[model samples]
Target: MSITNNGISIVPSFSLEKPATVFNMSIAKGRFSFDPELAFSLEAKPWYSLFWFRYNLSPKQSKFNMNVGTHLGLNFVNIPFPNAKDSIQIQKTDRYLVLEIFPRYKFSKHLTMGVYYLRSHGLDPATLNALNFVTLYTEISQIQLSKKATLGISPQLYYLNIDGNHGYYLTSEISLSLQNFPVIIKSTINKTFETKVEGSKPFLWNIKLVYPLKGGKIKP
Candidate 1:
């Protein structure tokens, strides 16, 4: 979800599926001043997990002066079935855990990039005993705007050597602030396709209306 307070912004978002999932929290403040800033996010997936945090100390004179932080996550899974009579039926679940550190750099006002390294493990009692591996990821984003609206695009790539699987995704979103109403309309589309993976490819399309509960500097 995305929220704004007095023109400041905070977006807490997440996604999930059968073999993969993700969680994230991001914040932006002081947009109308020379010292605008942002915060970190926590994310997790099927064979990978990550905890990353960052802060902008100053922007007017030292736009690159920023503080960085890190954390780790672990995941596992288990599945069991009963084939005999008088046996208890059970469905196994998978779990995963990872330990990770976050490194990032800011190039300019509308661009930033980051990378992550993780030590990950998984457990599924039904088909396999336990699995362990390491993974690496990189992400990039760009924000631009016309005189009346804003647009953002982000793409991420990942490598999982243990499973011999590599994946990439592209996500695009746009929002427009209407002239008369106290609302902004937003929509997004995300696509992910893999070389050896089999299953349905997920697609998402949504339109959201957002406005402040309490009035502030009304956009004219």
Candidate 2:
């Protein structure tokens, strides 16, 4: 069974002149996956959401593949983007029209390396007339280890640029698939080395434990 839960981050922030707490609460409707060679999905939370469409630029599922996509995301929560080394000045939510492309090549079926790039300069949601933040995001990962029934490890590099501000993050992630249950688990820990934004985090840690719902049920 899947349940709504609370998540904690070690990173600190200031909200309304007081330091913000570490806990976040949210709900999920479960996974919505697409079949066939053309891949894409839309995940909805309680609030506003976005759409994504992925088109394979090369062969659909090849050892060496190239793909491009767009993510339609909006920021309604006015969540502040943090800076690692300095205290940030809070701002409004940024509506995004991010363009993405990724290339992946596998040394073997179980091991792979890939890089993902995204660029966006967004509009203000309320008015939909103002444009503010321009950001670029990049992620690179290598699947160095894997166990079919256990875990997979990937060391990642994250770079983010907003307007002219920039930050770099190094992260490690583990994905675990259990033996008897239809559950997927993941954990990530990241450290930010430098940040141009003031309120950014120095370290980020997150975990996800959920059963992927398929066709109104958890798939085995």
Candidate 3:
């Protein structure tokens, strides 16, 4: 139901049939920047399944926001074997425990800066462990495009470390939203200018179209 210009090397999610659902709610509030919220998400594909829960501290009036989250992923992967009975590939499942933290400072209504940290560890095969990612990003949101449309742009620089291999990447996300339309458009671009990691893609891009339920109810 979606398309991309290029596929990711590390996470090859090019296949269709990926479904996801999310729930988010604000729980309590005390002072500025002390709002408490909770979010839960579940996603599944033919090759993998992922679930995550996040605790967020974001206030609409505050200049600072933070999110702490945890993820559990089950990945069905195939590897090449020297000699196999049925085929030259073997299937394996990798269970991962991922921890994440993101904190951002809103400099103005249009600009924000953030750093995201993630640590992933494999539980089943201990050898497939210790993956780390750090991302530094800045975003400009809600730029007026037209009377009924808005635009958002975000650029990120990130470092990935896995199994003693390191790589650096630059990525950007662009989004367009309309006030009365039910379809939203989003695009992403990624490039790896410097890397020592294997199977890393030098450049990747994708565009997604999301249609909300309101489309069924809105009249033309």
Candidate 4:
């Protein structure tokens, strides 16, 4: 789904499925510099043959950063399904209108935290009116190993209240990097403790390859 080029900073991702289903490919670039306290990222995704762009802006200061962006092309009613062949019926497509604001802070050099809140409302084609509220809490950390290796970890908690249905989830990941290769080996474990009233707990294992682009500095 996601891949990084040889030691460079480019990340490319793609997903495709079933006949007339939703398909998308995206590329993103990020930059961090020691001067001016600024960081930026740009990404583009094509869904069902329609294109969309996302841009991010953040301050490079130790304490906090702000993220603001929007979506272009295709409204809700035209959103495509990625796995329609596996489902009995296709869900109505909702137009794309997103306004998300994220604020983050670093408690120490190794520990950082953030909170996010988003409000989205659109037409579902079938339902004709769709609305939802999402809230999330996240924490990230890094531990230095040797001169060429590092370890990173992140945990995320999410609460979603959609119409009358409510759900909550917890996810975590850990990664390690070696000096010889331009790749970082990562393993992630995620579990959803509970959803609604059902105690549905699911676990997943993932191995990821990471490549450093411009700023791969490790704090001592």
Tens-digit lDDT string for candidate 3 (6-84): 3232232122223232222222324222222221112322354556666767756778989887768766666787666
RMSDs, each prediction?
A: 10.6, 10.2, 7.2, 9.9
Clashing pairs in 3: none
Residue 46 accuracy (lDDT) in model 3: 31
Sequence-dependent TM-score of model 2: 0.61
How many clashes show up in model 1? 18
lDDT of each: 0.38, 0.49, 0.66, 0.46
Q: Candidate 3 versus the native: TM-score? A: 0.72
For candidate 2, lDDT tens digit of each residue in 1-220?
2222223221111112211212122222222222211111112222223455566666545688766766566543534458645554454545667566767777675567777666665655443332222212222333334444666777666666655666666667577776677876766566778777556667655565656655444455
Q: Number of clashes in every candidate structure?
A: 18, 7, 0, 5
lDDT of 4 by residue, 1-220 (tens): 2232211100011112111122234455563211111111112322322343444466456377656544422332234458766544433444535345667777888877777655444433444132343435455545768887888887767665545555666656678877787766765554555555222335444455655545443555
- Candidate 1 local lDDT, 144-187, one digit each (tens): 35455555444434432335443444444556654456765655
Query: Which candidate, 1 or 2, has the higher TM-score?
Result: 2
Higher-scoring candidate on lDDT, 1 or 4: 4
TM-score top scorer: 3
Q: For residue 62, what is the lDDT in candidate 2? A: 63
Whole-structure CA lDDT of model 1:
0.38
